[model samples]
Target chain A: MSNGASGAEAHSRTTAVALSDVNITFRLADSGSYTAVEGASLEVADGEFVAIVGPTGCGKSTLLNVTAGLFPPSQGRVDIFGANLAGLNRQSGYLFQSEALFPWKTALENVAIGLETAGTPQSEARARAQDWLTRVGLGHFGPRYPHMLSGGQRKRVGLAQVLIRDPKILLMDEPFGPLDAQTRQIMGNLLLDLWSADRKAVMFVTHDLEEAIALSDRVVIMSAGPAARIIGDWRVPLTRPRDTAEVKLDPEFHRLHRDIWQTLKAEVMKGYEQTGGG
Target chain B: MTRGRLLSLQFLIAVITLLAWHLATTVPIGGVTLLPPFFFSNPVDVAARIFKWFAEGTIWKHLWVTLIEAMLAFVIGSVAGVLIGFWFAQQPRVAAVFDPYVKAINALPRVVLAPIFTLWFGLGIWSKVALGVTLVFFIVFFNVYQGVKEVSPTVLANARMLGMNDRQLMRHVYWPSALSWMFSSLHTSVGFAVVGAVVGEYLGSAAGLGYIIQQAEGVFDVAGVFAGMFVLAAFVIAIDWLVTLTENRLLVWRPVAAETRTQA
Candidate 1:
């Protein structure tokens, strides 16, 4: 109840993102209601980096989408920046797991969209987008289309695209999920570097425990679904300026990994048995 | 294929086809025409008739009339289709309500409406334009509807999260998506627009390439009919070439398939 109740109480103080008793259910015509998340609550403090790790199909993304205001909870509440979120969450930016970029836009145009939407003149937006692309190491790729870039490069563009808006909260759903292992590490380090410069409330959803531990201030785990809820929360005590590849070697990292895995393994096994190893 | 080799192959094909056509029409078999020269004019006769039409500049007026009708139909139909498609796509309830009626209208043979259009707009260019509009509208409308429906939900969510208001979302997300689909269907719709115009003219018209062909057939002038067809084809090919050029320029963002053939 502390996990479910903390978000609502935290609202009395300043909190970046607070989801209180959020429940999401999909109405199927033939079948009855399919509950994805029930009584799930979480809170992210200002400038904190939090990662939610869980078994596959554990409704981790549904929680993030609720915070983004893309899907309203059937019951419960979502408060962002100390205010109730009505429709779209303007204070947050989302990086999707799939190819969310507009394939028709060049890298620069894609990055510049938020500024333009905010009524910045086209030229200023373009210049600022180019600067952000440079920061993401894609300055020269400004004119290139999404299809022309490699998967890693596109993720870099997606990073630049979301980060350019300067959203107070960043909701990333497995942003580097499509990358190779080596690229994922590089991106994780890059994300850490950018985040260290100016911290924001980041809710990163990933199933990779090592990635979650390497890049987060706190790690939250949700149970396997049919109405998934938060099962565990742990503070990551890893040092700053961390390299995702190098951080795994620490004994403390291994200890945290083992402890979290102990809780996570049971859910993973249950999920497998229920789906018949699907 | 190398450009030179491809061009040579194309030239060879045209020459062989023309030779076959010439021999079939002119050469008699068993003292009987294999294909009557009066009905199937020899390539040489058709070519001569085409050269004569160009020399006298008599085909220009008919070509102009047909071009105007097709262009008008293409412009008007595409604009209306896009506007309606966007409106219907954004309003799912309205779209569902009108879905069956739209399908019914689209399923109706547009050629059947040509006579009715002629009755309404007379035998002028408007009747032909109306017919062509009908042909172009449904292709664009259906493609646009599908484009809007098939829009990547992830991308839409991303756009919304990026703080795009309704107008910006439509302009940045929906418009570009629908435009891509519409552009992909342009080749088909453009061809159909010409078909509509010519068919309308053929059914009954005082002017246009179709009218010339119809008049030539009435007087048993096979060469004239073939000449008119050749001119019509050349005109359509030119328009198609322009459409392709515009498509390349606008859709530069689209991914091209890797060149499967080994590099030279």
Candidate 2:
């Protein structure tokens, strides 16, 4: 709405991805079904950076998977750029939580595969992939296999692999879940740098609230699951081009953090309790 | 550890074994022969027979015949394995339906089929190829199947997310994965391919190393049998070496245990 002045149909037009009253219930092996998310509705405006944050197993990833069309929501609609999503969201790039790289391919080949599959010539795709790899600070590591690289290095390649295709929307599910704290911050900043330069509709799901606040324009929260639903939404007031680590020092950042924590605390405690933890 | 030193050491070991064989066959112990020459020919006699065959060029025809049969079996069997393996992997229903039959066939000792193959294809190279195909097919089929099954789900999902069509997914995701497993099982399949050919020729064939060995054994020529076995051993070793070189070239991407550790 802020970007679009056109009346009536502007909401749907401006929206890059919309999930309306989605209910994802997975059928268990034993004839029973478990509802992971229920009545979840959210809209990501074109080029908007929205992060979905929640406690562990609160269906944070389920929402992203729904957006990705990895599986359909049991009961709702998913629209990509106002068009109904069918088999897959062709306009969106997905960064899986675990290692998704083809182990047999070199870093360059993995990054270029998206382009190659889309009918780009090998030479052109290879050139563009090289440029993207350099953007991710891995120009010389092109020949290395995924197993030869460290976790952080592999994450960089994954980023390049997804980004080289220039997807209109980015669907990330805990992209930094496996990294150490320092590497996580580094990756977060790198993500912001790339996203800021080429704005894309990003739905980043993470359990780390701090990460959600640092990288996203708006932070949305979900309660603990067996029917998890979005409980709160807050627009981050921090200015643009902010460093992920340095943003934490601001007073406004602390105030926003405190407010969200109070609401998140109960849900997090409930989440932990559900998992048989304290 | 150097290449030259390793080769010499291996040659020295071979010499010692031959020396032991010669002493056992030729030398008398307390005026009694430990290993009779008629049963176990001396190494020198076996060596001379091998030299004589090669020098006369009489072995080339049989070697060529056996190589042709083995090569045909390997090509046909591997291609069939790969095609069927991909089909079964992509179609779960088909795989499930054929599971019992597949298990039963694979469990049966395939050597028994040599006679049947000879009957169907005749006492020619085709029979030998058919026998070899039976041996090589299952080894490659299982490897391909395992390869496709073990492909990382995340990698497959990522490929799908890249907007790759079914054909592209097979080329990008499945083929390379399955190829790796197939290549890893190469030596076994190759050995089986040769074994199949030799066994078939032994059962009913006019040509091939197996035929010559059969002829020698029928005549009670122990030295000829020993010579034939040594040649077969050398031939197998040469093929295995080629396989190793091919594996190194193709699987260069595989992480070598010590040399290519995960880099930070």
Candidate 3:
């Protein structure tokens, strides 16, 4: 691709992530293979905030993992900033939905490890890790192990762990899925505050419709799986510096939510039906 | 339930049991001894024998020998176990190839290996240490394998995302995880190490706690046999206490479910 040539190509060159016609299939333990996502294509522009909201088990996380180069899509291509993706997308930082913090390490050490592994000296990495901890409102919690922290506090540390590395693309898979409603709202605000300071292309995955609309610049929806596809893409018209709680009261926010939900409701029911019996 | 009350209750049980034993051995009931002193050796004589051994400092050398053998075995076996365990865990193909062989070896009673070890290493401390190694190895090896497996996939994925290479992952993630698992079985493995040493020494050795018991048994000294057994029990408890301390130090990050209850 030679980093492309023309002005239009140059503009496309600024694309932070472009996954074109990606298909992901997983081989089972038996002599079988299951297709999760088929012909899935989406692009995240530089500094754009995008949320992929879908029903549970709709292979939404699989799509994010594909973007991260966690595994190659079985039948399609992944392109990062005009370069063909190969192994781990080095320019990205991923925040998993599960408990990923090393239980044996303190919060500070977990945050510092990224830099340390990249050859930064211990003193400098720890100092910067402390700064990141402070930014995430966990300045004094550096010494506490992951088990000792509350769920909300641990999420804060997780956020710090990713943000400390300052990756070009931040891939989050339901980063607030485990927290309570109140705590999720608080974390949503904290995430927006950090993203605003140093904007990156973020691909956030969640099932919470209200959350998807509240925090994102655009909302991407997916249909139910066994070859799930991106079904809808809607731009949120609400302005930034928007509080997650206050934005819900906006009539425009309601309109956008109503429109996205209309296309999403059928898929949500299908997902539930698939999971209902089992 | 309270600490002081529990301690007093435990002390009371011991005193009651000793009193019963003392009365049973010395006093005849219905013109026949309840527990003949020749067989049971009365609690008083057993206690006095233990006291005399300590007071004369004659038991220290043998105790030291057994402790040395057990400690060496523990160190060697645990190290080898951890290394091999890591090897088997990370390399699935190797693990798969060796799977049946590992199971077969583990299935074999470790005690049965003692005679062969003595034949190979002779009747010196190395043989006892070798025997102890066999006993300690499997407990740690299986635990370490489990620890590596028990490492949350999320944690490993996050570490990879954080840019840890294979060696770094081994150090920060795998080692700590395996070590925690090893510590969980600390009491069992340490007790096995002592058992291995004692068994090796008992079979045929010049000196050790086991040898002392063998020597006294050869002379038909019942009190001495009882005294040797008591000393071994006490020795094991002391080593177990030290294991507990080491476990506490190494696994401070491990969540203790009863920690809050115990503190309160």
Clashing pairs in 3: none
TM-score for predicted model 2 compared with the true structure = 0.91
Model 1 whole-model lDDT (C-alpha atoms): 0.89
TM-score of each: 0.95, 0.91, 0.96
The native-contact fractions of the candidates, in order shown, are: 0.94, 0.83, 0.75
Order the candidates by TM-score, highest first — what do you get? Answer: 3, 1, 2
Off by more than 4 A, model 3: A1-13, B257-264
lDDT of each: 0.89, 0.90, 0.89
Highest TM-score scorer = 3
lDDT of 2 by residue, B6-102 (tens): 9999999999999998998999999988899999999989989999999999999999999999999999999999999988988999999999999
Reference-based lDDT, residue A78, model 2 = 97
* Model 1: pairs clashing at backbone N, Cα or C within 3 Å: none
* Winner of 2 and 3 under DockQ: 3
Give the alpha carbon lDDT tens digit for every residue of A121-235 in model 2: 9999999999999999999999988988999999999999999999999999999999999999999999999998878889999988888888877889999998999999887
Model 1 docking category: medium
Interface root-mean-square deviation (Å) of every model:
0.7, 0.9, 0.7
